[model samples]
Target: MTAIAVTIAGTDPTAGAGIQADLKTFSALGVYGATVMTALVAQNTTGVQGVHDVPAEFVRAQMRSVFTDLDVDAVKIGMLSRPETIRAVADGLAEFAARNIVLDPVMVAQSGDPLITPEAVATLRDTLLPMAMVITPNLPEAARLLDADPAGDEHAMLEQGRRLLDLGPEAVVIKGGHGTGAESVDLLVTQDEVVRLAAERIATRNTHGTGCTLSSAIAAGLATGAPLASAVRAAKDYLTAALAAADDLRIGHGQGPVHHFHALWPNLPGEKR
Candidate 1:
């Protein structure tokens, strides 16, 4: 049976982040992709100029339509721009009882534009956190979610990951890509263990959609029946390779996107190693 993964996120016409990135990740990982746009972002690799959130009722309707018709195996959520949107999503997930929900707490964009409202942060923590199988937040987003100082060292990042785990997600992945270091270290904190995934930081500006891609890839892996740890491990591996093979071809003048299809192509698949 073909696995289906749904992404509840904003629409990025630039295709770097949000629903476009999630769908691309799902497709690359061989999972059928579905989406519910929570907001529409008018920006690209450069920066975000405007954001218009979708009506909460319409968001619910979209979820209903997808859950009613498809056998969704997993879900990836990102860019819920409003508290009402977050509540509506939580309601839909409860109504449908979707499994393997991966939440990417997206607060800021790669261009440093704020993607989420300050008030919506509480709603996300209280409403959506409990429903997530795993929540992926970058260092800055994690700080925002926890209301902690954003100037954290590696130790602080791990502490924040542990704190986020208490908010109800079965696991938390604190992405260290935003940290100031030569190596990017993502910490996965569960109730029982903490696993660290460290990789050499790729010095490329083409990392616009990394978080969205990672979360969606993890969702696809979960939908394919991989365990939580295994899914995260695979996701980290995939994103690392994707970053290393980033299309420095410069699609846009600003921060470009990762080479999502680097693993595909006639002979390039083996080159991923």
Candidate 2:
């Protein structure tokens, strides 16, 4: 059976982030991908120029449309930039009793562009955070959730990840790639245990969609019946490989995108769809 996963996110014309990246990651992981566009963003590797958010009613409608047809093994959410859209997502998921939901706290972009508004942040925390099976936030996003500076070290990252867990997510992953280090260490704080997933940070300018790709990869794993920790571990490995192969092809003049199809055509052991 093909695992079916849905991604609720804004659109990135460059396909380096948002729903575009989410769909590509899902397919690469051998999961069927569905999407609900919350917004349309005119963006590239360089920056975002415009954003048009979908209405709250429309977002809810899309959710209903998808849930009614697909069992939806997992759902990955990103780029809910408005208070209305955030609330609609929470309500829609609750209405469908959506399970194995992965939320990527996409507060900012690789180009340092603010994706969500101040009001939306509060809605995301108070309303949507509790709805996720896991919430993946980088150091900067974790800091924004606490209204402080980004974690400067691993200790700080873990500490903040624990704090975020209290907000009601089943687990919180504080991405350490943004921190200063030769290796990236992601802290996974859960009710049962704290798991540290460390990987050698690859050097490349082609890292435009790391956050979106990682979260979607996790969602795909969950959709395929992997445990939470196992899902995260698999996601980390996939992201590392994708990032490593990113520079092999030139997609944009600015920061290029990671290779989502790196494993798609290659017949890897259990990865053949």
lDDT by candidate, in order shown: 0.90, 0.92
Provide the lDDT at 192 for model 1: 94
The digit string of per-residue lDDT tens for model 1 on 137-239 reads: 9988888888888736778887888899889999999989988778989989999999989999998889999999999999999999999999999999999
Query: Pick by TM-score: which candidate is best?
Result: 2
Off by over 4 Å in 1: 266-273
* Number of backbone collisions per candidate: 0, 0
| Native-to-model Cα distance after best TM-score fit, residue 159 in candidate 1, in Å | 1.1
Clashing pairs in 1: none
Residue-level lDDT for 44 in candidate 2: 98
Q: In lDDT terms, how accurate is model 1?
A: 0.90
lDDT of 2 by residue, 1-273 (tens): 879999999999989989999999998888999999999999999988989989999999999999999889999999999999998999999999999999998988899999999999999999989989999999889999988888898888888988999999999989998877789899889988999999998999899999999999999999999999999999999999999878665787799899888765554454422
